[model samples]
Target: MKQQLVFATNNPHKVAEIQQQLGDRYAFLSLQDIGCTAEIPETGRTLEENARLKARYVVDHHGRDCFSEDTGLEVYALEGAPGVDTAHYAGPQRNAKENNDKLLSALGDRKDRLACFRTVICLVQNGQEYFFEGKCDGRIATYPTGDGGFGYDPVFIPDEGNGRSFSQMSTEEKIAISHRSRAMVQLEAHLKKQSDVARPTA
Candidate 1:
């Protein structure tokens, strides 16, 4: 039997990406699936804190194994202006286009375009907590290009990419090297270790 776990997020894109990356090792549950409709607050000052807050909220409220992740695009030139506020960088509306526009305007012809995407995942199971982090070095584009991805994907180009934005890449290609993907890889390994320890020796 597959172990059941709740992914503490309502974002379809994120849920889909994670589910695709995790495969069949676990049976994933969504907030809607478990009747959790309350808006979870993200009052943390950092990605790790926010991820932990969300995961803890689900585990405490639902009493179930749950995981949450927080991702940010930190631009070196901008002095990491959007590190923890990536979603609401522009305003409280959380509009992706506005956020991207604001980021580009903030850069405003500066030559230093170094940036990185970072993701932190927090998992809470049986009152035990774990964290995994991943980061992808990249540069911010002058303008948004592709329309395939959400958030800063259109304006962010990974260091290992072929000069194309993440939005330009196929989902399979993006998942192969995304910050979230890297974090999920670590999570998979940890879960496997826990499973092995719990298995009965013959």
Candidate 2:
């Protein structure tokens, strides 16, 4: 049987992405699969901190090897107002559409629309913790576009695109060179090199 890993996340899309990214190396599991109902507090000041907090929580409480990741949309025009709070930027109660709309409104007259998506992943096993970061630079569209993807994908135009948004791209295309995917590649490589995945010692 493959090693079963608990992914500290409630989002099905994220879990699915990770499952595919891992490429059959291990059996994927999520917080809901293990009966974790309490919300993981995102008290960290940065993406790495938040990711480690969630990953460590799974291992510490669930007593299993686990990993977690946090992603954010950083807009240069907004001075990165929502870097660490992408999901709840418009408040935790609203959905993805609300969050995206607010972001576009905030950048009303800005022509540059320069922005990027960043993902910080924390992998932990047996008290060992490692952090990996991935970033994709792009520009924000004046209005949302396409129907594919989730979250801010509708308005995120990748660096390669002249103006097309992420929602218009296929899943394979998005995964091929997305911020989270790049970070996962780095993380998977690191985990392979180091047998011991544990929290850093002081």
Candidate 3:
């Protein structure tokens, strides 16, 4: 029998991406499937804390396996102003364009162009918690490039992936080198180990 996993997220886009990454090995369910309507408050001070909180919350409430992730953009030039508040960097409304523009403006006349994206995945199984982290370093472009990605993807030029920013690459390409993807690789390893331990011996 397959194990059930809950993805602690309400965003349709995030849910879809995670599903593709994790594949069919596990039975993944979104928050909607578990009848979770209460707002998951992000009171944590950092991405690592937030990710763990979400995963543990869902698992405790639903009594099932669950996972969650928190990602953030840290601009070296801006002293990481949006390090922990990438979700609402611009304002409470969460306008992607506005957030991008605000960051660009704050970085006026800065030639450093150094930045990084950090992602942390938190896993909760039977009340046990685990964490994995991944980082992608790159330079921020002076202007937006492609329209493929949402939020600040147009302005984030990854260290490798392609000449253009993440917004220019397809989903497959993005996942190949994304910070989240790296973290997911670690997560996959963790799950594989669990599967081995749970397997019956001859």
Candidate 4:
């Protein structure tokens, strides 16, 4: 049987992306799979804090090894105005289109479009916690483009990409160089190390 690790998120997109990135080594469970209905509090002041909060919640309540992550789009010109508030930038509605519109409006007539996507993952296992971080430096597009990704994907263009927004790329293409994928690479490395240590020597 594959080992089970709960992911402290109900978002299918996030769970799917992570599972795809990490592969079939371990079975991944989402908050819904564990019967967790209460909205996990994310009142943390930073990405690391929010990720820790969610991971801790699963560890304390579900009594399982799990991980959680918080991602934000930081615009250099805006001085990171929407760092922690990336999801609810426009309002409590959490509307993606509105959020993108607001971001564009906020940068009206500004030449600088430099930005970056950052992800912080907190893994809690056997009462121990670890953090992994990843960043994708890029710039915001003058207008939203493509329709492939979710959230700010339509507007955020990765520097590594070929002059295209995240939404312009397929899932495989986006995950290849995404901030989340970068963080997951570090996490997978740690998990492998733990697995090796626990292996029985022949």
User: Can you write out model 3's per-residue Cα lDDT over 1-202, one digit (the tens) per residue?
Assistant: 6667788888776766667777787777888889998788788999999998888788778777888999999998788868889989999888989999988898987899899999999998767888999999997888999878677899999989656799999888888888888998898899899889998999
lDDT of each: 0.92, 0.86, 0.86, 0.93
For 1-202, candidate 1 gives per-residue lDDT tens digits of 8888789988889888878888877878888889999989999999999999999988888888899999999999888979999999999899999999999999999999999999999999778999999999999999999879899999999988899999999888899989999999999999999999999999
Which 10-residue window of candidate 1 scores lowest in summed lDDT? 18-27
List candidate 4 stretches off by more than 4 Å: none
| Estimated TM-score for each candidate | 0.97, 0.91, 0.94, 0.97
Residue 51, model 1: lDDT of 96
Global local distance difference test of model 1: 0.92
User: Model 4 over residues 114-146: C-alpha lDDT tens digits?
Assistant: 999999999998889999999999999989999
Best by lDDT: 4
Q: Which clashing pairs does model 2 show?
A: 127-198, 127-199, 128-197, 128-198, 128-199, 129-198, 129-199
Between candidates 2 and 3, the one scoring higher on TM-score is: 3
Query: What lDDT score is found at residue 159 in candidate 3?
Result: 88
lDDT of 1 at 65: 83
Q: Clashing residue pairs in candidate 1, if any?
A: none
Q: With candidate 1 superimposed using the best TM-score fit, by how many Å does residue 32's alpha carbon deviate from the native?
A: 1.6
